[model samples]
Target: MSRQTNKLTATAVKSAKPTDKPVKMADGGGLYLEVRASGGKYWRMKYRFAGKEKLLAIGTYPEISLADARKAREKAKERLSEGVDPSMAKQLERKLGQQVAANTFQLVAQEWLERVHQHDVVPDHYQRNRRRLERDAFPVLGKRPLSEISAAELLACLRRIEDRGHVETAHRVKALCGQVFRYGISTGRAERDPTPDLRGALRPHRSQHFAALTEPSAVAELLRAIDGYGGQPVTIAALQIAPMVFTRPGELRQARWSDIDLDNALWSFTASKTDQPLLVPLPSQAVAILRDLYGLTGRSEYVFPGARSHKRPMSNVAIKAALDRMGFKGQMTAHGFRAMARTILAERLGYPPEYIEQQLAHAVRDSNGRAYNRTQFLEQRREMLQRWADYLDELRQAHPSSSQSSAQ
Candidate 1:
């Protein structure tokens, strides 16, 4: 027996009045429009699977036009002909869609950042990494499934960043993507990291070390210039203290009042890079500068609070700008103080490298190759810093021409 199909036209379906009960208008091949008494029109299909009749709801009228409804009906029939149940197939497609949506690259990267990355780095580092991903990677590959992103596609994203002449940033973005991909693999959201396949794809970029003055004469001149700077009072104080401590600029700016004990001349805080507790034995010179600056910023949390707000730390570039003002822009940098101290301490003052490195909070390994503990050379480092401060005092007080020969 052959059942008639296409018995309803578009006009007939639209003009068909709803009765007191629901009515079905057949279009063709198990497709029909259900006109409910409540004025709702919906498209449905009636089909047989394993000898049992079932229904599939396509969509509503107008939203699902007649041509679109016919196409959907044909696709559903194709699934049925392939020995698959169309209703179950539709449900499976929907579930897969939901799964893909849940496993998007952006979502996985965010989970990685919050659960693992944030806790591993300082807040500013975490924030900068997040911003890098947002600006560079997220807009392109964010919505795609992490496991499905090919190596070439990811490289294309990096290439766009490279094309902008930000070769270093492009490399950094690539590394960040690699981290997210590795995280995805560990969390079962991705099958593998594609970044390994991208080796040698990026343009070669020469690494540039931070500008530093290792010469004792230049360091002496730099110290003299820092003392004479006429900036904000807090900035002047920071400049005075910078060479004495020579901790990373971020660490110095973020120094808290509670971390210092003027009586003992020690500052103790966790190192941002190594995440280890560091003990800085402040010289009498550094302690004096702190004591004088305390009256102005003693109540604030940060030793070097921001200019506009006491709640936040000072701008990271404050010292760099001060150096530029002092005519030492290319000659020396704020970080140059570390190289200056390390060089003179070992080459001039004849201090052991171990003591100077330990004072610098660097990871100096023992004979067995294990990292030495924080307190390993405490007493020697204390003496070394005091002497280092005295040496700086000598340099600052020396006549300009005599500064070069004043080193011990």
Candidate 2:
């Protein structure tokens, strides 16, 4: 005979007091409420799976209620009919959920940053990437599983940045997220990278060229202005040497005295962006300036040590502020010295393009597709820099009004 079901009532369940022993009220189809002597009530469903008897804990009293317990019993019956074990299925679902929680986007991204990204870039570059992710990407997507993050969801995150009128920042954050997703794929935390699907999703941003001066006459005027800068002796020397060597401002300010061979007229160091060795052929003028500055700051590690402490490099804005004070605020900038050299060397002085680019520490390659070694064209570059420095001296000696008037 079949077992009787629906033997419990809500009125009886609420009023039924706990006794010295536990009591169970049957609600049919193997569902029942067990009231313990401790006054705790729980719902359980008894069943037989694969010829073995088992019990499934549905929930607790008042919380599960009589109606909810009956519904759970029907669902468990459906699972049995399909040859699925309800208890085992529930356990598997819970384990999968735990795995998802463990492999969240933020956790995987952090691993990528520490193990991979940090080694590939400079510390400052790595820190900037980390800050971009933390400030924009983390709060919204951090807790979500890497594999579960869809391309549409990623686009939504980037759209927020674009909505704030930071189109360029949005583009950068998108690329940053792409790196994280690719890392996640390699680590098996993600199935695929979704960024490729977002090619046209972001607003295109125009590249903002750094303010630079390319005209020789204008550059001459700026050079003359630099000559008149009444800054500290250390800063004056940097400004003077800046045009002669034309290195990136960061590399110039952070230059270590040990990296230069003043005797050989060469400055050799690893390029920050490419992490490749670069050899800068210092002209006699550049070497002379360094020698004079050495008397004041030669003992310090950084050639242009900060004003407050000799331990740190000068502030990045120090040269910019100096230029502003010299009344070349919009007309020229510290980095303009490089553009000035590149243009004048190729056009005015008639130096080869490859030599100019190589001197710029760019990744210029040979005819056979090999990157030029740091020492490539050493002799030619040495001559070019000397002539370039001498030409600058001529320009500086020429009246500032003379070049501007000649341009007219």
Which runs in model 1 stand beyond 4 Å of their true positions?
16-19
How far out, in Å, is residue 2 in model 2? 4.5
Best by TM-score: 1
Cα error, candidate 2, residue 303 (Å):
3.5
Q: In order, what lDDT does every prediction score?
A: 0.88, 0.88
**Predicted candidate 2 versus true structure: per-residue lDDT over 59-121, tens digit per residue:** 998998888888889889999999999888878988999888879999888988999999887
The superposed Cα distance between candidate 2 and the true structure at residue 55, in angstroms, equals 5.5
Q: Estimate candidate 2's alpha-carbon lDDT, on a 0 to 1 scale.
A: 0.88
Model 1, 324-372: lDDT tens digits are 9999888777777777788888888899988888778788888999887
Clashes of 1: 0
State the local distance difference test value for candidate 1. Answer: 0.88
